[model samples]
Target: MYAYGIDLGTTYSCMARADQDGNIEIIKNIEGKNITPSVVEFISPTEIVVGETAKGDAILAPDNVVLYIKRSMGKQDENREHHGQTFTPEQISAFILKKLISDAEQMTGEKVSDVVITVPAYFGFDERQATENAGKIAGLNVLGIVNEPTAAAIAYGAQQKSKEDKVVLVYDLGGGTFDVTVAEIVGDKVTVVSTEGNHTLGGKDWDAELMSYFVAQFCEKTGVTADEIYEDGDVLNELILKTEDAKKELTSKNSSSFTLSMGRGKRAKLEVTVEKFDEITRHHLMSTLELTKIALKQAATKTSSKGKSCDQFDEIIFVGGSTRMRQVKEAMKKEFGVDPQVFEPDEAVARGAALLAHFLSTDQPQQTTGLGEGQSAADERFSEVTSKSYGVEAQIGNSMMLSHVILKNDAIPCSNTETYGTLAHNQRRVNIVVYESNIMEENTELSFGKRIADGQLDLPAGLPARSPIDVTFSLDRNGMLNITAVERFNGSKCNIIVKTEGLSESEVMTLQAQTSVIKVSDGA
Candidate 1:
């Protein structure tokens, strides 16, 4: 029993559900807002809190505050250590997933076991796998992890019943990340032809600038510097919330006013103009345009028909909260020569994910069979499709989410290789993992059957830095991949092999030993 779809976003998260007849609808959080703040808090390490309540406590523990962790998932070893526990971005994300699932169960009083998670279109193999692992940690039977832009297209494309295929540019800017996905959506299938974006930039960054502006104004108007009154966590948290409100207020009004409650009965009245906000954030908005251009170019390979190129875009759909800014809308209109069509940006992604969940749970159950050690009776229908691509994001210089290949849209059961090299003069071996997706920031360099034994390649010394190396990815019809990397000691070396298998029923049960939960109601 599937209850609803959850869009775990950078700044906000939401849930939705579809009826047996196939109609879809979104679920509102207790806040009365269609979108829920993506902040996840912890009552304890083993227990967590999500949505509005958690957002209230962000300043108290900013590092523990998991937001925008979904943009790209890499390796645990490469992740940062917060407090005492070393958390890979994926583990933090898993905590968020746990929060979402737990909140969903409490809200609907339904038992939810499986879910369809959403990611950015440009998420790489490491990132995608990291998201999957998050679901596993949360004890969820992930139906599928889909691209956020594709998810938006799915919700938007559902409105298009025409037999004629349509290409849409989903310009998705969430609180902490930006994603531009070009999809050829037809019928029930929303194919993510290509995707691009920056994981480090989003609406939150813009809001930070606003906070800075507010702080500066206060120093001038009241002669109080941030260092004087901003040290208090509560004061800072209140400021963050107020700034966000002002940002939203600017969407409808030319100027907005707010009084931030710092502490000790201290309050500051601030009024800001939309023009000022735009002046500060224009470059970030332009980045979206650049990402869109790249996505359009990458999608061109799939849009070779009907005089392709950017002309193939019949519609530019805007999703995510950042699209609400009038400046952003104007920029898009002026640049594209066409007005962008704005949907329920905050709600569409989750709704689309829910729909995809429904489809994958039924339409292509055959694609998900044998994903683990064994197949369930309900999953036997999809036993033919094998393997899922892994995505790893690495920070070369800028933070980027690179994909080797993505899910649902790419050809299944295929193999491909990307070559790398050693960095030292006489160095030989290098560590490599076979990840899924098109992002390139994190290093999740192993597969169940393709890990280089959880360590880096032992290279012989004295080689020039950055030598040639081959990383190969082989997939079967089941969508499983066997990743291998070859390293050189002097002239040539041996290949790195990643080995593993599916989760048998015993293994699945073992992994889920804690408790049993299910989505038995007609979801949100």
Candidate 2:
């Protein structure tokens, strides 16, 4: 059995496997393409289609096709009903995974059961769990969930063969998400200092911005309401698709023009210059830069105790297919006052993931950040930070407040304990709900986060009002969570598995069986 490293991306996904000689090779899909489109379409009750074919079929069967499913991974109410069948995000993702693994098996002629998947560094606890569940639904053993930026760093280190200690600012702008991570590479170990990102922002947003611009321009020239054109599904889809092409065209050209024909033989033609495109989408790029600065500032704050600043890191490394845009590189140059390096933007993450997969499956000694007593320079260690805060909801006086236990950016494989007293006299049971929050303070209003798990803890009967209960939040290296609450007085304990709101075990099993019956078309 071979362990593969998979970059299950929002727009595209790729996989890599190490050969018997320890050389990592990128595995192409059945179509002989390095990256497969993350698109899935349901053609019949027992037929599923993925990759380029599905993406091409989306225009004709928009209602049956699903794209950008990564954006809905951990949402509480995210589900798609296609052809009278409701599919959760995890199930849609599982179909994608199945396509990846099936093609990989055929391509390599090797059994693939264990794999390491990469996710955005800023993904919350629930999101990470959802990814793991997707792997499980695909009947694969997930070795770990490595962050995309860290994986890219590992690939960069291996490619450059640099032995000196340095810090890298990784800007990962993928098809449907954007993130910035600051990491320090010391010897063979990579430690993440800080990470910031917007899961809803990425190349798709840029395409949408350009689409809106074209629609607005068309409306002005044709004297038609924007809603009138947008209400036409076929016309709108075609226009959006053309706008994406135009965006890609402007990447190298000074301008690109497109024409749209309305009824009554009326048509409108519009030309978009590179400068105008940049002007219209400058705010989006600015948002990414702001996040980059935030990550840098956080890294600086972390290093201030040791007399360092954000300037300690001078080079910016870009990853993801979207980084191929000229405007992105221009803005990065202006922001950093130096030319940024694009290190295998499209393949770095997958390669790094392959390296990690190889490391975990082999008997090679693991790397450590500590002084080397017996560790080799070739071995690599990984460390991650929490993307969101973990806390419990508390009712103080007449208002509800969030009592934070772990703050964001805290190192992983860590645990924190917080004690709280019961509110009512003679309280025998308390409901403990674990929530993932983005707020930093202990008694802050939480406007963001999701409820991961909720359970009841039993206390001694007739317990006094001020009796204390100990709650502990533990996060593993993969960012999966476990919450335990203990009644100190009676020594009673309750454990909650911190997972996302999605299919239960039985539901997942049922879905898995159903998917097994639905044959996926081969990539072409």
How far off is model 2, as Cα RMSD? 2.9
Clash counts for the predictions, in order: 79, 0
Compared with the true structure, what per-residue lDDT tens digits does model 1 show for residues 1-524? Answer: 77456787778778787765568867655445667666655444445566666676676765555555655465444554444544555555655666566556676677877687877655544555566666776678877766677678878877666746677778988888888877665545555566678777889889999988988877676666779756766667777888998999999999988876554565668888999999988888888888778766656655534556633788889999888989988988898877899988888988877776665565434344333344342232111111133533322434333335334335443566666655457655554443443323234333322221233556666667776665556654323345555554444444433332232335335434431231111122
Query: Candidate 2: where are CA atoms >4 Å away?
Result: 19-22, 304-307, 363-380, 395-399
- By TM-score, the best candidate is 2
How does model 1 fare in lDDT? 0.63
Alpha-carbon TM-score of each model against the true structure: 0.72, 0.93
Judging by lDDT against the true structure, name the best candidate.
2
